[model samples]
Target: MNLNESDMKVQEPRLWSSDGWTARVVKNEDDDGWAVAMTPDGASEPALVGPWTMGRDKKNPKPLDQSAFLTLVKTAREFVRRSEQQLHAALHQSIAVTVGTARVTVCLDITPDEDNPSATLSARDEGDDLLAQVRVPPSFKLSRSSAVAWAEGGFVKPR
Candidate 1:
């Protein structure tokens, strides 16, 4: 298929799009400054948006260039990665404790649903074999004392 020049990568003064990312300079809503938004291809919203450099006149935004676009891409990718990591950490938690003379690791995994959010509390022995697993409320708090208490209580489903 023939692609027109406009359909190809754009490198305008205020807009740049290439390599699965687009950088657009827009007016800041909170102030007179300019802001740049970095959006990945196929995404409706920008993953990163921050202040942009002002032009020599200090009235207009600085032109978008190759160097600036690349920097924005890198920063935006890192920002997305960090956000994913934080969400993963919040959804899954683990702690290790001793049950009798053997070591065990307890984990809590949360499944977020609009209608029925839920969580699972599971334990694994030192050999990584599943000791027990039970459904729990999403609000259940996992702590060292709680884990130890559960283990000592014979791994029964907590009340």
Candidate 2:
């Protein structure tokens, strides 16, 4: 049968869509229980997956409802938000170092990509003016001592 746009829309009972999220109930392949997956709009995979409530018969999963779907969307959005915050903190780390009478800030920004992985070490004065920046290997670690050394060495690239 030829399917039109309206006909192609999924009408499965176990799947529900909300503002920008979708809740899907699937059987847990690892066990007899069921699980629900929450995926955000435009995302390929679910951002949150967890055990779901069982139906009265105990064989099938409880059907998705407005309350459950709303809760799942809230939880999945928070999970994605926290994940992004953690990744941002890891990628951009900074520390303050005391050099002479000025306090300088040293920041290590890392860009991780499969094709090209790189890191940059940058130093800024107390007023946040750029002092020196150099590209370093992705594996380079930033520490208080390293920052101090960089500042003491005239903001040169650390060995």
RMSD values for the candidates in order, in angstroms, are 2.3, 3.6
* Top lDDT model: 1
Model 1 gets an lDDT of 0.93
Clashes of 1: 0
Candidate 2 structure quality by residue, lDDT tens digits, 1-159: 884432333325699875777789998889999999988777889999999999999888888888788888889989999999999999999999889999999999999999999999999998889999999998889999989988899987877
* Model 1, residue 12: C-alpha shift (Å): 1.0
Give a tens-digit lDDT track for model 1, residues 72-100: 99999999999999989888999999988
Question: Which whole-number lDDT from 0 to 100 does residue 11 have in model 2?
Answer: 29
Model 2, total clashes: 0
lDDT, residue 74, model 2: 86
Model 1 bad stretches (over 4 Å)? 2-7
The true-versus-predicted C-alpha distance at residue 97 of model 1, in Å, is 0.8
TM-score for each predicted model, relative to the true structure:
0.92, 0.88
Q: Cα miss at 102, model 2 (Å)? A: 1.5
